[model samples]
Target: MKASAFMYGLITGSVTAAVTILYSTPQSGSEIRSSIKNASTDMKHKLYDVKGKISDLKDSITHMTKEVKELVPEAVHDIKGSIEQWQLSTEKNKLRLEKEISAIQTSLAELEQTIAAQQK
Candidate 1:
């Protein structure tokens, strides 16, 4: 008899608590479930969008790398050619300057000898 009384009290307490909780809730169960579903769907869409942007960024990087690979050798070859042309031009200028310096030295020696002869 004591066990039966204890079970009855437990059942009544459980029902009362459940009723209180259902009545005190703000939104209905369906509304909360729908909101959760919509939020999940929105998250999925955003995830897909981010993945697509990452793929595009990867493709852009790959294309830029290929272009750099092609251009670097060409740029190096052009620079080498320019250096060679500059060396050739400076060689010619060096020869011409040497000739002019020799001519100036010869004129100075002639003037020095003429002055000495006049003094004597």
Candidate 2:
């Protein structure tokens, strides 16, 4: 339970006790009546104050949730972009390596042909 709820419980218990005292004794009736209005009004203000604080806390949580929801998708898109760039780079390097290997093979064939001609 919330602290405000607990405070309300305590206040209600006190009011009950005060009423009990008022009925049990004659002098207590005048004293209880004198303070009852003030006590009830004070409790009303505390309740409204607690209610306002709760509303503010709820708004803050909702805002934070929205921010997190917005950020997560953006973060995922950014990671995907990085992965795509890395793949393109890897493909470019692979093609360059394949071209180099093909050229080396052609050079070796030419050298072998020259060696065979010389021997003939």
Candidate 3:
């Protein structure tokens, strides 16, 4: 049973015990019957209130679950797009660096050839 239901049961039991003890001391049959009936009505109302609260809580949970479900896929898609863009930019930078390195290598080889001719 739910915590709320268990707590309500305990409250109801205590109340019933108190009423029974009080009435048992010295009360007419008609008065006892009337008290019992009032207790019954009060119990019914308490039960109804608990049921309504439970229903509201269930609806709130369902709405929150749906919102989370809807947001998760969109969040994942955005992250994936960002990763792809970052990868593309990184590849472009790598290519540019390679070209710069190749140019430097060629210039070093030409300078070596010029030095050799000067030595001759």
Q: Which scores better on lDDT, 1 or 2? A: 1
Highest TM-score among the candidates is held by which one? 1
Candidate 3 TM-score versus the reference: 0.50
lDDT by residue (tens digit), candidate 3, 55-90: 999999999999999999999999999999999989
What lDDT score is found at residue 73 in candidate 1? 96
User: Which residue pairs show backbone clashes in model 1?
Assistant: none
Cand. 2 Cα-lDDT: 0.93
Candidates 1 and 2: which is better by TM-score?
1
TM-score of each: 0.56, 0.48, 0.50
Clash total of candidate 3: 0
The pairs that clash in candidate 2 are: none
Candidate order by decreasing lDDT: 3, 1, 2
Q: How much lDDT does each candidate structure score?
A: 0.94, 0.93, 0.94
